[model samples]
Target: MGCSRPGAVAIVSVFLAGALAMISLVLPYWSKMEIVTAAGEKIEVALGLWGACTSVHPPALDTLTAPVIANGSEVIAIEPESALSDSFTCGSFYDDERVRISCTSFRELANGQCKRREFRGPASLCDVATTASFLGDSTAVVPDATVSDWLSVVDNACHGIGHTAVALAVLSAISASLCGLLLFVGITCGAIESRLGRVGGYCAFATATLQLALAVLWTAEAHPIRYTEHAFATSFYLNAVSILLHAAAFVAAQRHQSLEKEALAAMDLDGGIHADGAATEDKEKAMGSSKATELVAV
Candidate 1:
C-alpha cells in the first residue's frame, strides 16, 4: 500500500479537527465568568462566536456581608465562597451573529444635578429589549465630535476584527475538509502521488495558519477584560486542539510523500536492471543462432 498507518491516522486527524471546529462554532463556551454584582446578585456569563448566555442567581444568604462596588473599569467583586454549580435562571442574549460591544457610558441628563453612568453588559434578549431606548444610543449622548469619532473608530475596529476572525475560522474548516478528502484518496490508492500529497500538506498548513490567525484576532478584538473574571472556555480550547491536529496532519503528509518517492525510485531501479538482463539474453541467443546456421551451411 502506498500509505502507511501513520498517514491514515493523519487523515483521520484532519476530519476530527474539522468536527471540533464546527462544534466550537456552535457552542457558546468560548469565554466564561462568574461575577457578583454590588447588589449581592451573582451572575454567570458565557460568550461565544455567535451569542452569549447569562445565569443570574439570587442574592447571597448573608445579609450582613458588605457589598463592594467598583466604580472604575474593573471586574465586579466576586464572592470566593460562591459556587458555580448553584442553580440559576439562564437566558440567552445577543443571539445575533454580529459582535456585541459591552461598555459603560456616562452622560449628563437634562437635570444638571444628576450625572449618570449606564453600564451595558451581557443581558438576556428580554432584558435588552426592555432597556431604555436611549441606553445604548451613542447619538443621544455624544458630548463632542472627538469623543464620537473615537467611539466610532473603536467600534468599527472591533467589528471588523471580530468578523474577520469568524470568517477565517470558517475558511479553516473548509480547508480541513479538503485536506481530509485528499488524504482519503491517497490512502485508498495505496500511495499518495507526489503532487496530491503536496497539495494536501499545503491545505493542512493553511488550516493551521488560519486557526492561529483566528485565535489572535479573537483575543485582540472580542475577548472581554480578564479583570471581570473572564477566562477561556471549552470552545477556545477545542480550537487550539484543532490547530495542533492540522499541524500533525501536515507533517504526516510530508512523510507520506517521501515514502512514495522512495518506492517509485526503487521500482524504477529494479525495472531498469530487468530490462538490461533481457536485452543481453536476446543478444546471446541471436549470436548462437547465426553460428548454428553457418555450421549447417558449411
Candidate 2:
C-alpha cells in the first residue's frame, strides 16, 4: 500500500534493469578495430572484450605479447639520396587470409624487429602501442601493405580501457546495484511502506541520471572528435536503454503514490459525511416522537 502505490510492477522493472546492467558489465562493450586502406579496402578485427588474439599460439588473456621471429636479414644501406627513412618494413603480402602467422615472437623496436641484426622487407604490422593510441584518437599512422591493391594487410588484437573510463564504469555499476536494492526494499518492506516508494523512486532516478552522465563523460574522454573512426559500443547503447527503463519505472511509482494519497483522503472525507447524516436522522426521529406525544396529551 505504499501510499497505495503499485509496488509489484516497480519491483519487476527494477529487477530487470539491474540484471541487464550486470550483464552489460561482463560483456565486451567495445573492442572492434576498424581498418581502412588508402585504396578503400576495409577490414575489421575483433579483440575480445577481456582479451585479444595477438598471435596464433594462444590467446593472451592478460597482456599483449608480441610474436617471436628470428632475425636473419642484414641492414639495408641508406644514402642521403636514397628514399630510406627511420621507418622499416618486416614483410608485406597480397591479402591477410593468404598467410598464417603465429604468436611466435615479441618485437624489439630498437633491435630491428624480432632480430638483433639488420633486417628489412614489408612491415608485418603497425606497432601495437601506436595502433592502440590511434584507436582512441586520430593523427596516428595507418599501416599500409606494399602492394597497391593489397598492401600491408596486417591485423591483430588488443584490449584495455583508460583509467578514467574504468573508474567511471565501476562507480556506475555500484550506483546501479544500490538503486536495485532500494527498489526491492521499497516494494517489500512493510514498516516503511509509503516512504519507501518515494525513496526508491528518487534513488533509481538519480542513479540512472548519473549513469547517463558518466556515459557521456566516458565517450567524450575515450572517443573524442580527434578520432575519425570512433563509434559508441554495445555497452554504451545497452546502458542508455536501461536508463530509459529506470526513468519510466520512477515515473510510474511516483504517480501511483500520488493517486493513492488522493484516494485515502477522499475515503476519509466520505466517511465523515455519512456519520453526520446518520446523527441528523436520529435527532429528527426523536423530535417526531415527542411531537406525537404532546398531541395525544392535548
Candidate 3:
C-alpha cells in the first residue's frame, strides 16, 4: 500500500540521515591515509620501514662510532659525516647486501688500546676502538619477520573491530528505518479498523525498542569511552537531533489520531450516514466547517 505524504517524507529523511551517518564515519578514516610524499619519494618506504623495524626492536641511541682507517694508516677515525655523527642527523644506509641500517656516529678519532666510552665522551686515541665496540653493542636491530608479525596482529585487530562496528551501525540503521516505516503505515491505516491500530501500536513500540537496543549495543561496543572535546560535542548534538525527530513524530502521530477521532465522531453525530445519505446534509456542512477550522489552527 502507498504511504501518506508525511510517511513518504519520513522515509526519505531516514535514508538521507543514514547516508550522512555513513559518510561521517568513513570519510575521516579515508583522509587519514592519504599520501603526501614529495615527488619520487616512496611514501610507504619512508613511513612504514622505520615503524615496522621499531615495533620489535628497542630504539637505539642516536650516535655511534665505527672503526675506519684513513689512507694506509692503522689509526681509526670516526667519519665526521657518518649517519651516526652528521649534523643533519638523518638518512639511512644499506649494507653490502642491501640490508637497511639506521645508525649514527660521533666526530674525533683515537688510537692505541681501545677504551670503552659513553655516547657522549672525553676522547683519547686509545678510546676509539672501545667506543666503536660500545657502539656496535648499541645496534638495536630486530628481525624483520618479528616486526612484520607484530604489525599484522595490530592490523588484523583494528580491521576486525572497525568493520564490525560499521556493520553493526548499518544493520541498526536498516532495522530502525524499516520499523519506522511500518509504524508510519500502521498509524495511517489505524483510522479504518481497530486491528490496524493494534498493528500500528505494535510497530511503533517495536521501533522504539529496537532503537534503544541499538543504542545500548553501540554503547557497549564503545565501552570505557574516553570522549575528546570534539567527540563529546558532536555526540551531544546528535542526541539532541534524535530527540527532536522523535518528538516531532510523536506529535504528528497524536494529531493524526485526533483528526481521525473527530471525523468519526462527526459521522456518528450525523446518524452514521454516508455523504450521500439525506440525514448527513446539515451534519456534513457542520463537520466540514469544524475540520476547516482545525486545519487553519494547525
Per-candidate clash tally: 2, 13, 6
TM-score: which candidate is best?
1
Candidate 1, poorest ten consecutive residues by summed lDDT: 102-111
- Candidate 2 stretches greater than 4 Å from native: 1-6, 30-32, 36-168, 189-193, 225-228, 285-298
Better of 1 and 3 by TM-score: 1
Candidate 3 Cα RMSD after full superposition onto the native fold (Å): 19.7
- Alpha-carbon lDDT, every model: 0.61, 0.49, 0.35
RMSD (Cα, Å) for all candidates, in order, is 12.1, 14.4, 19.7
How would you encode candidate 1's per-residue C-alpha lDDT over 1-298 as one tens digit per residue?
5668667767888888888877887787777665554455565666666545545554545434644335586434334423212332222333322233221211211223232233443442324232211122232332233233323322433367656766786787788788888777766564456466668777888988998887787676544343455578899999999999888888887877777778789999999999999999999999999999999999
C-alpha RMSD of candidate 1: 12.1
Query: For residues 1-298, what per-residue lDDT tens digits would candidate 3 score against the true structure?
Result: 4234444444444444434433433222211111111221111111111111111122223333544545564433444434222111111111111123332322132222222222322331123332222222222332233233323322332344434544544554554455466555565544433344334334433444444443444343333222211122233234234434443454444444455566678878777456447656878899999999999999
Give the distance in Å from residue 27's predicted Cα in candidate 3 to where it truly belongs: 6.2
User: Which model scores highest in lDDT?
Assistant: 1
Better of 2 and 3 by TM-score: 2
**Residue 177's C-alpha lDDT in candidate 3?**
57
Q: Using alpha carbons, what is the TM-score of model 1?
A: 0.64
